[model samples]
Target: MTKKRKKEKFYVEEGETVADCLNRMAANGYQPVRRMEEPVLKEVKKNGKVDVEVSHQRIMFEGKLKEE
Candidate 1:
């Protein structure tokens, strides 16, 4: 039997830089391995509101890591 690895998530606050935040997390026992290497379905607009002109887009912001 094989053990399944659980996916981890780290939601950052608005106006937070992903790279900076990830680095901080890494120093504190959370080692960030890789970020979005593939495509994903996501929605983007001027803001939180989705735009009809450009519907959901393929995006990837996944930063894999293990928390201590």
Candidate 2:
């Protein structure tokens, strides 16, 4: 038979804020990751006026997420 990988469970007590939860996760040996912001596009011009433009953007928190 193949072996199963172990996973740790996360839980919150009576009351906790986002900061508190993050702190708990750090205490448990979790790493912080960088966040990605939406991209901006340059406006196009037509007949010396404003024209249409398209921009693709996304928000991502890369790497493993911390739990508390």
Candidate 3:
């Protein structure tokens, strides 16, 4: 059988809560080791100028394989 990755990343999908993501990780035989949030950027044009702004935050979790 192929070996599974020791580390994996899980993202909180749209309309999904952080707790839901954690439960998903557990179901996949992984435990969360770290949590992170990255800003989703968007560009806006006003007065013939372009500006960048944060649209939202994307939540992610780094998971480690659970030991048997």
> TM-score for every candidate vs. truth?
0.35, 0.30, 0.94
Off by over 4 Å in 3: none
Query: Per-residue lDDT of 4-67 in model 3, one digit per residue for the tens?
Result: 7999999999999999999999999999999999999999998999999999999999999999
What stretches of model 1 exceed 4 Å from their correct place?
1-7, 37-68
What are the lDDT scores of the predictions, listed in order?
A: 0.50, 0.49, 0.97
Instruction: Give candidate 2's error at residue 2 in angstroms.
Output: 24
Candidate 2 lDDT: 0.49
Candidate 2: tens digits of C-alpha lDDT, residues 1-68:
65322333333333655466556656655544654555556688888998657565433332344443
Question: Clashes in each model (backbone N, CA, C under 3 Å)?
Answer: 0, 0, 0
Candidate number with greatest lDDT: 3
Better of 2 and 3 by lDDT: 3
What is the C-alpha local distance difference test score of candidate 3?
0.97
Runs with alpha carbons beyond 4 Å of true place in candidate 2: 1-6, 31-68
